[model samples]
Target: MSTKQENIKQLIEEYMKVNQMGPGDRLPSETALSQSFRVSRTTLRGAIRQLESEGKLLVKHGSGTFATCPLPSIPSSLDRLYSIGDMIRSAGLREDEQLESIQRISVCPPDIAEQMRFSENEPMIALERTRTANGEAVAHSINWMPEKLAGPILEGDSFSGSLFQSLEFKAGVRIVGAYSELTVPNYDDAHMTRLLKDPQATVLLLKQLHYDEMNRQVLYSLDYVRSDIFRFWVRRTR
Candidate 1:
């Protein structure tokens, strides 16, 4: 995001705070906002679109933009990549800080090595945790990343909360996007069944290849989500 865009976003947020705008409240017209901010219509629209993508605003056809209702469950913001911890906190849910496992891989698995674009013998770090919401296990996630990107944090106790945040704060790397894949896992799978502990449970499997600002692959993750606890949907815009 550019500085001007950040200013416009902050300005709009302040406007809402000052006016005490709630859900369904209409925002100022684009023309009025453009003129008031002294920015081009294109720039103003870009900032508004960013807010919309974040689920902060809604745009109606033939009607003006309005404040959207609070998110019920985490919606897929395909345009922007975010950390699992951030999503949990955004929905007012509790996060379990207990890590199931974290270890270093001296010999990278072939498939994972290919995904991270690492040499066959190159090392990596794996982190696994079971996330909870309201004291119930909601998901189990396993993440792998290049040692160069996560070595220190993975080896130390500082690896808590959002790994994305940890990477940025510890290593100065910013994630910008991800290649995501969603699927329904088979109930008979031993590993998944053991993690979920219910044969009849419905599960949503998410696999993502995370990329940094320069489009370099930084991390890969697999998450097994309990569908009964958390529902996910994609937002499509023409």
Candidate 2:
């Protein structure tokens, strides 16, 4: 890192510290920051983008950048990739899953079908599970599978069990890529009320379509993550 960059980074840190800016808080504009520090706008932009990629900030479309979830490491990108188990375990957290509902059902909603590439009326295996880290409820996940493949999975799976393992070992399938979307919402639904403490809790929802290495969609999952306990990052090449 260059000395100029180091100085600019320190400036950002000082600003955040002085403002007591926690996650999701908006930061000052680059123009304001540059003027305050008597630096060029390009330098300020680089610094802000650095903080963004570092997970210290998030650049929202149309709006200025805001403080975001804490950054653990550049390599552990919870959003870009990683299993739920791996994502939590990589953060030095002890994680477990509580199976709430795991049942076979026929017919998925059309919107859901569009996301998972399934017909509007396909039979699917629906599994709703809660993920706990350090004995606290951190996330709730719902997974859907095709009936032909998922009809045989029993409920004897433990908290330490991997869903991928269950799928591959029991049903003979592998997961490769996932098409996912992340958002923060005011969680006040029945599931959130039962599993979380606050009705106003901010949740990081990850809606994913899990595809195998052969490029066949296998699983549709909805991961509702606690914004407080978990954070995810994304990296882009300049």
Candidate 3:
């Protein structure tokens, strides 16, 4: 790809982002895009062809070009445990985080404490963040851990995206497994809808109890995943 083609591709992606274009959204006509970008038709077509080859755009004869899904749907297996960041990376998307939500020291609630095998009033470091893939919100996560294990994270600025990575590298704790429960949520949350950028989005709630190598429960988490962007499956042998 020449520099001009790459630049044009980036511009087209930006245009899609700005317009909130999702799968099946049609792009402007080639002439219109060429005129808007001030580029010749040949260059614009080159960029479009590249995007089409990459499965980001689809060109149908006589039907025009349309945007494919901006991010690939993650097909996760139920037999294994994966961090949010790991899942996003496996889907060939850039994993990013936005910590604009709550991250603070708080007392663990009774139900969560019981799940973590901690006292009801146990001190915990609670973190709530929106996980993004290629700058698009994909999941919202809320995690609670005993303050003793994750206390330093609250005071430091080392957290980039993955809490699992941060825990292993910073706190010397490695999560080996988890007990998970998955469900489809029937309630509407305006806050989550706004963050996900889709008012009609369906959400899958995943609740997990994480255990370390020592077989000690260390973390409890609630992950609200955008069902449209992620697909979870399990293999069954009869």
Among these predictions, the greatest TM-score belongs to 3
- TM per candidate: 0.64, 0.62, 0.68
In terms of lDDT, model 3 sits at: 0.82
The digit string of per-residue lDDT tens for model 3 on 17-84 reads 99999989999999999999999999998898878755588888799999986567898998899998
Predictions in order: lDDT: 0.76, 0.73, 0.82
Candidate 1: list runs displaced more than 4 Å.
1-73, 155-158, 194-198
Candidate 1 weakest lDDT stretch, 10 residues? 191-200
Give me the runs in candidate 2 sitting further than 4 Å from their true place: 1-80, 155-160, 198-200
- What lDDT score goes with residue 3 in model 3? 98
Best by lDDT: 3
> What C-alpha RMSD separates each model from the true structure?
15.8, 10.3, 10.7
Candidate 1, residue 154: the lDDT equals: 63
